[model samples]
Target: VDIEVVQETGSTNADLMSRLPLLQRPVLRVAVHQTAGRGRAGRPWLTVPGGMLTFSLAWHLPQAPQNLLGLPLAIGVALAECLNTLNQNVQLKWPNDILRDGKKLAGILLESAAASEGGTWIVAGIGLNLQVSDELEAQVGRALADAPWLAQMDRNLLLAQLLNALASALQQFAGHGFSAFLPRWNALHAYANQSVHILDHGQILHAGIALGVDLLGCLVLQTEQGQVNVLAGDVSLRPA
Candidate 1:
């Protein structure tokens, strides 16, 4: 894998996607300071220099895009499991958000670009908070991952460990698909088996018990209508 670390960047994911056309080997681009980082629904990811760890990894895949629909969930499983090895209480929210002790600690965004006449390339961007401030805490309207070591851990060591685990997990995912990670994801799910509500905008679309995820990485909700498979998009899940 090729590694490039920048002092600053607009968004590593954007950069990787732009370079995807010419991409040959796997590459990992890390930004020490990300000026323009955004998560799902275009929400800005706030961070300060050395306060957060931001990076993006790009790789070519022989599989078609549709067949990798559950890629994000698999990535989340990789991240949560890595963190769990270092510190306990690492749980995953559906799709791909890392929650530490029920609070958001890190966010992941996965994007794929297809080269003309070739296979697809995917970039997985990650934002992990290293140090939290009262100001940063105030800016977060929702859950934020909080832990004592997050503010004191060694960034380099953390980055190395995470990158290795991610690369290995991605390789396994390419062979086994999301089915292999489903059991692991369910084991670390923060809301598994809990009553929850799936919300789009402010409206509740479905209310049911969270039964973990299916092989395709769709959230399995046991609703009144039946077992409903929920896709991740503009929708949000919350405890009911």
Candidate 2:
């Protein structure tokens, strides 16, 4: 599967990991409309051209699976199993952010490149906001009109069922990694038990409830003064 339907891109995973080693094909897809996209604090992925569903994908991971280190939590369990097939309350927030009823919509950005003589080459980008025009959610300053639980959806059958459930969850995560996707990523977790705000490296780590994600993907809160994993982070679901 090698697709490419572009119009603009400042980051389809950095223009497909800079052309994936002159590509010969190991499954490369690239659907874009707009994305000067960026996230994980650098934040900028509002991406509105035709309203959203930007994309990117490159492949290859022959033996890479050291506990999976949460490759964006397995692309947020492949976009929450493709927004649970459009019934969509879309969960999944840790490490990748996609939420629907809770507001945000979609996002997944995994990048890796360094194979000049080294190794590694990933690209997996995505951005789905299907259609939320309050003038693009106020130019994405954020406040989807008080989230009315994401008022029903359609968007071309939810982007062809979210690219066929993210190509069957990236072919079962490049063939069985992340423990075959941590029990459907703790069943589409969205702030797993609740209290949050990890942010790290500027120190704001106070947590209690979010226990899911540790085979290296880090983030496993549960604190009343106890469990706290986190590794290169961000948590933020606080406000109870």
Candidate 3:
């Protein structure tokens, strides 16, 4: 595991993706601040220096899975598992959001590219709000959430734990796919078995009862018409 910490960067995901061709092994890149952070659907992710955990890990996969769609959900499960050990009781919003008490505590972004020689390289980026300042809350126009224990824990220690958990989870996923993690992920799903609204591009797509996720990690929604498997895309889910 190669690790690099920089004072600032545009986006750790972008940086790692750009270097994947030359990377001989997995690399973890952490930045003190990200000037241009990104989120799902090209949304901007804002961060304050020293107040958030922003990092990316680049790993090479010898053979890409047939369905790479579940990778982000797998990563979310890894994060929840790590945070649960710290007694945070974190929950996962479908696909990749991490929540604490139903509020956003962290987010994940995954990007992959074909390797120069062979195989595929994936970059997984995570942004966790350790402490939400008043200014940040105001900028976001809402109260954001953080892991309370982060104030007492050393950043490096927390990072180490997260990486360890992630490595283990990734290994399992590579070997067995997302099936092994389905049950655990559903147990931690924030909207499991609840009536929820699914939106795509700001328009209502479906209102249905959450039936957890399928083997492929797609959200299975029991709608009036039928059961719909919702894939992660330009979509959002909220309580109905």
Q: Each prediction's Cα lDDT score?
A: 0.86, 0.66, 0.89
Clashes of 3: 0
Q: Per-residue CA lDDT of candidate 3, range 1-240, in tens? A: 888999999999989977878899889999988988899877888877778889999999999987788889999998898898897669999878999888889999999999887888999999999878888888877778876587579989999999999999999999989988899899999998899999888789999999999988789999999999998778989889
Candidate 1, residue 7: the lDDT equals 95
Ranking by TM-score: 3, 1, 2
**Top of the candidates by lDDT:** 3
Model 1's TM-score against the true structure: 0.94
lDDT string, candidate 1, 1-240, tens digits:
899999998899989988887887889999998888988777788886668889999988876645676888888898889988888999998877898878888999988878665778889999987767777778876646665675577778888989888888888888878888889999999999999999999899999999999988889999989999998877888889
TM-score of each: 0.94, 0.35, 0.96
Residue pairs whose backbone atoms clash in candidate 2: none
Off by over 4 Å in 3: none
Name the runs in model 1 displaced over 4 angstroms. Answer: none
Off by over 4 Å in 2: 1-3, 6-24, 32-49, 73-93, 98-106, 109-125, 128-132, 135-194, 197-215, 228-239
